[model samples]
Target: MNDQPAADTARRLTTQEAARALGVKPATVYAYVSRGRLTNRRDPVGRGSTFDAGEVEALALRSRREAAAPAGELSVRTSLTLIEDDRYWFRGVDAVELASRYPYEEVAEWLWTGGPRPGARFTAPPEALAAARRAVAALPEHSGPVDRLRVAVAAAAVTDPLRFDLSEEAVLGSARSLVPTLAGALLELGAPAGDGAPVARELWSRLTAADPEPRALEVLDLALGLLTDHDLAASTLAVRVAASARAHPYAAVSAGLGALEGPLHGAAGRLAHRMLVEVLERGGAAPVVAEYLRAGRAVPGLGHRLYRGEDPRAGALFGRLADLPQAAPALAAARDVTAVMARHGLHANVDLALAVLTVSCGMRAEAGETVFAVARTAGWIAHALEEYQERPLRMRPSGQYQGPRPPQPLP
Candidate 1:
């Protein structure tokens, strides 16, 4: 017992060490800090970073238990992609490179209709456009764009003609019509007219507010480009599952949205933004760090699961954000928080960076969610098209029950 205190005082571990002690991933460790679920003090060199070894062990021990189900049985694999390596290939081009040059609409068009007008405008079969519009209009008033999008997908599924064929035209048409419909419904509360206007143009008009500035459009475009796709995230996987089941485009997208609604997957940006604001609102990073240490509360937006080291994308965007006037303050604070956090040596994830971006743009909490929904629609459509090429019909998993055999034992 005496040795314990001596050892703990002598040796302090980084957040990585603490994560290992807790048998959780390093990212999970950062999440704990962000959420105020765990606390660690700073080292002498830094203001607030050093964590007590004993505290970590106690937390880890408290969490450890027998598996809920045997490991092998519990580990089910699917086609859900994570895109941990390499660039997002939009058609044949790299997404990161293209987004720097093209408008968000172009990227969206590429994802939906295939690289730059390969064919004629995808016109959804006559009644389908009207039905999509009606669905949008029907979304309860004052609903969020993303929520409205989810509802619209559900409503459109029933009325979508050519849903069963999974043909190229059907997929492309669905992409064009649905994107604008959701954009209009969410942005304007008006349904799609399915008129002569180009899908991209209509969507851009609706997405912007009245009296928008030059930068606002640019920001919107940039945000769209940023959120577009992440290889095979949970939402994209959901879209694939629906596609594999031969569900139509709208149904498939609805599936993706369902996955996005989960806290762990898509709500990350919102969570990070809230946490950062709380830090700023209470009294900058120092006091916030102090209180966090005292309370054992974790900080948000300071970590990632995929990037064991650091998120390259976060680093890249961080550099570019120096000039944006609107998002500059939040961006600066993020920089401060990140620099200060290095005493602890944890890196920022996309969520953290995006939260900063969101704040810089002066968007509502809901806007983050909306951005995710809109950006991911392109991926969902792509996945749906992929599924169409695969074995259609039902792609749902089979259930195998494991329980005591009943009648024979009784007999």
Candidate 2:
């Protein structure tokens, strides 16, 4: 064996060498250092910064892994929605065009059956609605809308004897009942019963006590249609996973509801709503944005990963909100936040638009999240129906083992 120190044997690379290994420029290597994605140490011979060769190689490997298809990433075939060029399509038609012209129920029916059922309306079965309401009422008085929704879904599931039938027709039947059950169950404790209005009208009653204006009600309906589905979102993935295991539609929806509790997912709108309120209170977006930056929190409602430009959903909603006199202030606040964030290449997202609606309508901060859950229920059901058509357990992915070898002595 060579008589050499371990430290001496460890290879070190100059900045240029590290950059070459990483397939990036020297400045990019330093940029990586600044981002805490890589580390550098001063060269012992005063040749500027040096990187551990092992670390550089590891980073290169990681970069390649990230640039390529991620390990265990599954490619699911879906015909329901397509997102490209910063715009989305549902069943080969422009989603914005479809949502703007059609009621939410019609759009949802089209998503499920691949054909427009114009003038479609979803009404909850009396028994299912009653069961859901009872379950929602049992929750703690302070329970948020999403919490009530989850409980309501579970109770509604108990009342459906045909929930186990995985046939497309039966699943569609459950979806029609479940979506309205979710909305009807959230009726405010003392609110009057719905008069069989559209889903948005019924939902509006629960979200705020203010009477629904004609234009505002239109915006709400448009929002429900726009939010009906996005291909393979986190909650939809959860629903698909549950469905892959042969879970009933109700259980699959519950899994999706559970996934929505994450702040990065369904709760993002609530953060945006609170930020808008703060901007209104402070009289400007500058201070609120500065505080968010100082606290290292991403200013919510500013960017979306899928869209490099303006979010189409935000663009659509903002276009309509401009027509409402009452929405002017909140709309201005959203624009101010967008203008401030534009310097960083961020644009307003749907959450900001939804916040504008909730804020202007006298709704609470959580109202956006409530709207998201109720709207996304249609999406979860769509994904569940798709999953049910695939082979059972098709989504199960084998784990990449990284632990010590099994031959090691038992601990």
Candidate 3:
């Protein structure tokens, strides 16, 4: 009887090949090893470690299973948005198509209600704007935009005498003003505020030193629409939990802002921005990709659990950027990075496209979070409104006792 392991059992997949089969990045393969989700055998004949092919396949299957796992307590009925088949639908409307024609004001309203109003207005009362400015100013100058936004929301709630009014009409009114007012106050905190324009334009002025291009403004508007709502994102769930307790719209949004600060959520865009900036600054994509792989860092902005192939939002935005002459160099660099990552089967997601847009438009590094926070506020309010109508405090979940049961005496 042969004691040697069968050749099939001994087969190993190189990092690149493993990543392709697993539909992730090489760094992720290393991460799986580090986390003990997979095992790697050092190749005596080759330079880099290789993974057991069978184990890699097992991990890939587990990933797919997890993606389809039942929501359990995380599931809540929401008619606001749907992300399926690599596309986002807002109330049964194609987000990409809707984004091309509408500003954030109209898109946000559509999310809140079931209908789209063509000429809806977005305005912030002068007093609320002034109060928000003072509130934002109270935060330390070093605070991130998201932190300041949270501060502003809490402060707005404090100053509003009628914040307890949670009626649908009142909520919608406050929601309309909330996003633009947050934009205005944050703008006043640093850069000069734009002349009263769309909220996207005002946000653009606040985030960059460069003059706004029409195409860039349009792109920003489209991005805002695309990002306004994604069903049950971590931050959105946080918002819903707060809203379930009958929190004011401002408080609910504050909850969301708090959650967005996590790296795995909205802040991912900022990480992606930094990565793209490094690529552009180093004047090449390969070096940056190689450096990340060497350090065993997951390449930010590539791959998503929800999208099987290209993220539709990323594809749509990248398609728009393709036509803009100003974005040519940055777009070229992004493509190079994508090409390198494609070899490992990692595709760009919305965060990557957003980073590209932010860098191309000369926005600050943290502007990605800024955009995500502001846009998602619309969704948060919509969700809050939905939660307000349901039974309060419905999010309570039971815990399973996995730990040693209170150190019971040995029998």
Candidate 4:
């Protein structure tokens, strides 16, 4: 063995060399230094910093070690939408403001194809609506709303002969028709097409078991607009994964719906709804919340990973419920829950607001999820469209193997 200092043996690299070693760009190397993730020493005779190869290698190993799941440390570039600093933005427009001011279709138009023109009103063809209705009815009574929606999408896809046309115009045209069609079918609205009413109003008429009030209708519209898109969610990732394979929009949307069906993603609304019911029945938020914590279960709808404070969408939706006289009790229970969470430094999320909307409108327990799926369809289409422009099949991530090595021959 040769005697040598550890520093003398450790290799040093320029910024660019370090980037290559890390399998990233030079800017990323700088970023790693700025984030204090890697150490950088100033170049003795030149401009930029130099990285210790050992440190860079250590960082790469740590990155791999920490990323235990598919979701860990993955980043994708997109100009479609953003969720940062507790604010959601679609093409730089504030989503909270757009939800209160504009229709969801308009929001979808901006997401799918960037332009100044507002999209045409969403109207479904009679045949497509009929096809979707049959699909929804065929589902078992135990099926969730998302299940019916998923089946309806598949059924509609089978009915459209031109669904293979993956052109942007064709795909967008289908999306515009499909979302409203799915909503109408779920509500069983048998009205003629081209009626001059907001799509949310039509949906509200079907979802609310009681008489539809203006305030409730407004809340539905706002909710739809706010939920239209979120950046790189699980369902959106599924949509992009399918789209990267050059799948047709319908197939891509089906993939999204499939991913969204899980309880952790789209079905959080149902859990939140159940929690609200328990809170209201127990006469306050504390007892039910206490029981949930004692059992080591998280309080559904009480917190989100993204938002540092309250979810802005939750704030927007819940604030509007105040004007409606019918939403008083549900709203009160929701506030109680928020208050209890606040003491522990947790905040309410959009799921809680959606649960409040579900209960206050006298809709079924799964209505919030249905609304979420329908609204998120716009975002899926947007993501698919964006993915179509990218090099196909680029989402293939490298797998790190941990299995045992090949056995020795004749062992």
Measured against the true structure, the TM-scores of the candidates, in listed sequence, are 0.67, 0.82, 0.79, 0.79
> For this target, which candidate reaches the highest TM-score against the unseen true structure?
2
lDDT value, candidate 4, whole model = 0.81
Looking at model 4, the pairs that clash are none
Q: Identify the runs in model 1 with alpha carbons over 4 angstroms from their true place.
A: 1-92, 112-114, 117-145, 157-159, 187-210, 289-298, 343-345, 393-400, 408-411
> Candidate 2 — which residues are off by over 4 angstroms?
1-71, 189-193
User: Ten residues in a row with the worst lDDT in model 1?
Assistant: 72-81
Error of 2 at 408 (Å): 3.7
**Can you rank all candidates by lDDT, best first?**
2, 3, 4, 1
Worst 10 residues of 3 by lDDT: 187-196
The residue ranges of model 3 lying beyond 4 angstroms of the native Cα positions read 1-74, 188-195, 403-411
Please write out the lDDT profile of model 4 over residues 1-411, one tens digit for every residue. 125455744577888888777766676576566436787777657888777788888977765554433634555557778888999898888989977887778878877777644555888777887999888887787988778888888888887887888767888889988888777777443333246456786677566656667778889888998999989899999999999898888899999999987778988888889999999999999999999899999888877888889999999998898887878999899899888888778898999999999998888778888888889999899888777754466676767778777785765
Q: Estimate the TM-score for candidate 2.
A: 0.82
1-411 per-residue lDDT for model 1 (tens digits): 334465676777787788677766665565456435577665656554666767777666544432233343322222323344533456556665666567666676666655574333433444554666677677666766667678766666666666565666767766766665565545442233346544433444554333344554455556566567766677877787778777778888888988887877777678778767866686567776666667886666776656665565566466556656666778867877777678777787767777776666555555567666877787688777755654333344445668766665554
lDDT of 1: 0.63
Better of 2 and 4 by lDDT: 2
Q: What lDDT, from 0 to 1, does candidate 2 have?
A: 0.87
